[model samples]
Target: MTAVPAVALRGVTKRFGASVAVEPTDLDVSDGEFFSILGPSGCGKTTIMRMIAGFESPTAGTIALDGRDVVGVPTRRRDLNMLFQSYALFPHLSVEDNVAFELRTQRVPRAELRERVAAALDLVQLGEYRGRKPQELSGGQRQRVALARAVVGRPKVVLLDEPLGALDQRLRKDMQFELKRMQRELGITFVYVTHDQEEALTMSDRIAVMSRGRVLQVGSPTEIYDEPANRFVASFIGTCNLLDATATGGVVRVEGVGAVPAVGATDGDVVVAIRPERIRLLPADAPGGIPGRVVEHAFLGDHWLAKVVVGAAVAPMQVQVPAAEGARLLRGIEDGAEVALDWSAADARVLPAEPAASSTRTQEVAA
Candidate 1:
């Protein structure tokens, strides 16, 4: 028989008077997996996290942990811990005391609490700074203390609500790896909430892209990045170039670009999305390529983003190429110079546009 999920939500709904914070949602988080809920601000990512932590009760449906219902369990009574975006450390308390506070409240033996607190600090590589208060530590260090405190009690699941959001770019990247390592070593399920797509892509075993109060898609990073369920997932997850095309038989006719074979188009106008990296810039005389004029270019460390205007389209199409090749292309090209653009048929995704009444469906995916 299959083992029960570490955390599961069945038709979970949260309504604050007239506002529905979380629509009826269902999800399953496996044991020892790193799962993330990703979306924009006010997209209900935190509402879902709060529901799991029992900080907020669902208006309907059930929340289960390890096959047992925990729908009404109080935050302190549930066998789960949460690390908040703000770190939420007590400024007056020393690091050791902060990490041991939960255990102390539970009436754990003084001797055992000391040992457990020491172990938690050591796990976060802050053992020597145990005597320092929250004000005495760096932002990243304080965040570590919050993490250490959450894990000190050996909770069945840990929920991190944008735990690394306060750190700088470099520190945030470092902590992503550190958190993933810590999660693996402890063998506990981690349900993380973040609006950062890159962070979710880097760490999650699976990610649920949310919008408004609904989950748009749940899949591995590669699946979500490569085969997005719809246009919102494609556009929200990363940079994309969209082309208006007409579907006739098995071929999609792009204006000025001619026809290309597509797999899913059946009728009407279709929107084709292609990643910038998938596009190749060719010389003016190249065959089987659409002609365009270079509008602008920006250097981005290892590569360059070249914007080219195709036909009457006002929006410039972005193309990413290696810096070395970009230098060569730049030497032979200039602003307003005509060039050719090409991409493989398999690199593009065709999706039907949702109707006006279903426009709200797109908002649901942004959560």
Candidate 2:
């Protein structure tokens, strides 16, 4: 028998008046998996999460948790818990008391509640801080307290809505690993919602990229990064050099760059998208290389970003090189210096020519 998914959405949608927040969509999240909904603000990613949590009712379709329809169920009755960006810890309560609140409300035996709270605190590495109040803890510590409280009841699934958004960069990175660790140890299904691409790519088993109230693509990190479905995805997930071209068989012709290689290019007008890191930069005199002139460059700590205008192309092509290699290339090269661009056939993807719209024709439902 096939195992039922931990969470399932079929044609689920929401609209406030005539403004559609989420289009009809279908998705499944497996048991004990970490899934993420990624998109920019006002993209309707949060609306989807809210509907799943029963905090908002869908205008159409159905939601099932472990194959049981939960459309009209109250948020408290659903077998899930939610953690928010704000931590939402009680200021006056100690960590232990906060974690024990749910159990006490259920009238669970005092001894069992104590044991569960201890286990929860220990799992979050906050056992020693059980006596500390929310204000007494660091940002990360308070986040962990909220996490411990969310998972203490052993719910079937946990929803995290940009839970690390409030922390500093370093603290947020640290908490990413911590979140992954706790999820692994507890083996609970986690559905995380975040607008940060890096965060979703780092922690999610699979990601659903949303735009203007629609899911554009759903795939693993590597798949989404390497094989973007369309022009929008190719540009949104990371930086890419998009050039207008005409493709025939395995060759694509750029206006000023001449014929280049594209393995699976569709025969017609198309857009060739290539990652900056995939292109090689050589001295302009290099044999058989596409000719270009460096227009500008920027230092990004780990790598250097350079803009090169090739032939009669209207926009500059971006190239990213490692710090060491970038130092050698930009050492004495002035703006307008000559250079060459080269890449393998497989590195350049020929995407269908279409209008890459980031926003849809509806207002997003506010969180």
Candidate 3:
């Protein structure tokens, strides 16, 4: 931890005439760590990547690479590489040529260029595709070629802006494992930008949740998901059931559901946030439980995702039942069938009410 950070930003801000794309912010990416800047569209995630890649200059503040300020450095001189969502490979060049283009431009020796390009392609398991042009490869294979090109120079940090966004779900998942493996083996710092919450949670060592051109919270994946800093983070990082309620001593009382265990809030309006998987279905009319009815259900492979409307809950709360357990309980679980729901008090967290938004802007709870 004592080593100089691979990348650092101090009071970084970007202004595009009248629009502020990124607010003043401070960030430090540790050496060899997989760090992700996660947020929805237009939340400044891509602007952050552009700033780091030297494509866009910040209106204020400094950007340092390996502790050395590089505000005026051109992209080629900065010793950093950017991988875009588009492959951007030269159609005129073969895969090997595409991967070797950067090194060749740098005037690297022929033998060393060949060695580095081969090593990079091998790292991504694309050695055999070297002779084929990018137009001949599948989306996933072309992505690997782009990945190989990015790392052939062995930059200290690599900026990836939704490089896998174009692939299908199955291919994207497969690429995630391959990309993580490459990052670990190369021991390079990764500055990844993505809007996909699950991708960030699965691939990043640490994540910075951004919103409204500002950083809401920065922490490890577990901390960001389990102990989100605010309501924005709580609702954004995963699927959460947000229940509006009034907080009393050690509990939040719901209008129709009764008292619910809660903490860290005063005697006023608050919210209780719980994940879907943590809730359990109890026998109808069970003691210390809230009564509800199943209004909808869906089959999601390993588990059944169902929405239960409890009298005390402000809206239909989602519940996840294991396939085996769901089979036994689903006989009594149908549209309009009676049921009861209960969850561990520790599983539910108290959070502040959402901040009021400007009427002109679209209101959304995103993940």
Candidate 4:
């Protein structure tokens, strides 16, 4: 973090009647950083985004843009641009006009406005589409137009709210790269809000995982994924197998299974989380393995997903292996056949059981 963040939210809170949309939270976004606020619907990610964009004022606390308090500033005067999921293009306007709307609104000189607009369009690879309208362009191309318009103003930060949610899966993935490239080229700070885990993981330089109007964790993709702060974060970011266990003599005694080696600090009641990909199938009675029955299996194109009934919990332990390798491994093992599961001790993350949840006092504003 620099002396002054590109966008800073200090003790920012927003309440709607008795419902808390966002609690008092402190966030600092660095200059040129690609930061995302990720959460499920009703998690207040959007509310926080609106507050930062000046669409909604925080119920309490301060919002600073480059160390300057902009709580009372208008959106346009705040030197920020908000890109919405809807292209929000004027249907009657040409591509160039759509990108030039902000500049014209600010009454920039005709000559300089043209130069900036052309540069913006060219950056998005839509230089030739200037003569066309939003309706004439493909969804991806229209999205490019929206992006060009967002950066055309050269705002200090661009707030994007699910900007790619409308595109098809493949097209959306493609735009992730395009958006990343534009962000780098423009060197503008981006505060993106998305509920799609894959989308956030793919595009964010750093992500703040939010739940119930509170940020559960803030870290890089690897940090949030590999070292989650709690069970909510671990389960939300990716697939996780949470099994009950008890710590004793540097080993976790899993219910209905043998003892497994533990790492880090493990004490009292605990939950062990092992990723499906980390587990390996072995013949029953193999050393350092727990025997179980293969309850179900599915081919997922890139890999195979297997459910093995084991441990005290009724839920089966999941195992995933490369499609080709899985075929060879299960060559003779029929469904319901007995097998053993093994994984490196280091791969298993032992977490404390029943971590306390925060009780932040806040609510969202009413429409």
Candidate 5:
């Protein structure tokens, strides 16, 4: 038998006044899965989360939780918990009391409430600090307290809204793993909202990419990063070199780059998206490749980034070289030095020239 999705949105949309915050969209998050809604601010990712939480009524369509329609449910009536970015722990309450707040409101028996509160604090490693107030804890500790409070009632779903946004880079990284671990231990579905690509990529089992109040694409991290759905996804997920080209008879021709193999391409204008690490830099006079001048280079911790301007292309192509290879390969290749760029034709994706144009029919090219 097919299990019902933990959270389902069918043709869901939201509008505020005359402005549409979310377009018609469909999404299903599996039970016990870690799913992320990723997009820039105002892209409607948070709006979708709010609607699902019953805090905002959708302008259209229906929302379901475990096969039951929840479109008109009140926020408190939904079988879920929400953790905000601010932590929101009461300054006057001790850690244990904060975690017990929900159970107390439900009037759970004292024995069970105490046991549940202790377990929640232990799960978050705050059992030893249960006597301390929110103001007595560090930023990370306070965040943990808020998380414990959210999950203490054992909600079937947890909605996290950029909860780690205020932490330092290192702390944020630490919490990412912590959050994933907690989710697995509890075996509850997590629908996280964030604008940070790295956070989404690192923790989510699947991600929904949103843009301009629409869901652009949804897929696993590898699929989202390596096989983007369109131009916007290609550029938004990572640093890519997008070059305009003309495809004709199984080949794409870039200005001054000659014809590159593009099998199954329909003759028309297209844009090629390739990762920096895929482009191999070579001596300008070497056999076959695009000739260009290295305009700049920067030394990153483990690698180097070089920008090369080629042909009639509008922008320079970024190339990533390993630290060891960079030291030897770029020994005397100073600014303005001529170089050649080459890559396996199969490494590049041929997308439509227009921004956000769907490329479901697009295929990988080969020599």
Candidate 6:
């Protein structure tokens, strides 16, 4: 028999008085997969999460969990657990008590509750700190306690809403790996929500990128980063260099880079996007290259970020190179020094110019 999806949202919509918080959104999360909803604040990522958690009702459409409709189920009845951004730990309760609170509420036998709480603490590697109160634990420890509490019930799916947002940079990175390990061991679906692109890239098996309550695209990390669906996705996910080009017979004429044939482009104006690392810098007198002027350079530990002025464009094009290689290239070079830039046609992506109607259409649709 085919296993049902862990969670499925079919044309789900949510409205808050005058605002439509989540537009008609459809998504399916597979069993035991770590899926993420990624977007900026006010993009309705949380609203979708709330609907899945059964904390909020959809104004339209249906939601299913393991093939059973859960639209009207209350939060407590749904076989799902959520770890909020705030740890939400009880300050007065010890780590063990915090993890056992759910069991006590269900009136489980005291012996069983104690065993479950101990096992939960052990799962999070907090067994030694079971006696410590939330106020006595470190930030990461408290977050782990919260995670243990959520998983103690062994729910079908686990929802994490920016669960590591409060931790420091190093701790956050550490927890990303820990969470992935825990999810794999538990064999449960994980639906994570985050606005941080790096967090989404590192943790998720697949990410649904949203904007204004609409999902722009869904793909693996490499696909989303390397082959974005449109200009917004390309620009938002990472740093990209864009050039205005006119297409003629499948060839794009970049102002300084000359005409180059590209895939999926015909006769019209298009935007060419390439990553900084893909650009190659050469001396001004080097053959077969486009002309530019060095405007600024900054050494960033392992790499150097160089800004180069090309043609009438105001924003300088940025290129990243290894620090050692950059040092060699910058020898005797100074501000306003002419330079040559070159990149293969295969390195650039030709996209159609965004229609003005899209801006108005998105607004109207959102309205």
Candidate No. with top lDDT: 2
- Return the TM-score for each candidate structure: 0.93, 0.96, 0.94, 0.94, 0.95, 0.92
Residue 185 accuracy (lDDT) in model 1: 84
lDDT of each: 0.86, 0.90, 0.86, 0.87, 0.88, 0.85
lDDT score for residue 64 of model 3: 95
Off by over 4 Å in 6: 1-3, 355-367
268-343: candidate 1 lDDT, tens digit per residue:
7887788999898887789877888888987798998899988555588899988898887865566898888888
- lDDT over C-alpha atoms for residue 15 of model 2: 84
List candidate 3 stretches off by more than 4 Å.
312-314, 356-367
lDDT by residue for model 3 (134-235), tens:
889999999999999998899999999899999999999998888899999999999999999988998999999988788888999989987776778888
Over 162-258, each residue of candidate 2 has an lDDT whose tens digit, in order, gives: 9999999999998888899989999999999998988988898999988888888999998888888888888888888889998887688998788
Off by over 4 Å in 1: 355-367
Q: List the residue pairs that clash in candidate 3.
A: 257-312
Clashes of each: 7, 0, 1, 11, 0, 0
- State the number of backbone clashes in model 4: 11
Shift in Å, residue 29, candidate 1: 0.8
lDDT of 3 at 365: 23
- Per-residue lDDT over 84-174 for candidate 5, one digit per residue giving the tens place of the 0 to 100 score: 9998888889999999999999999999999999999999999999999988899999999999999999898999999999899999999
1 or 4, greater by lDDT: 4
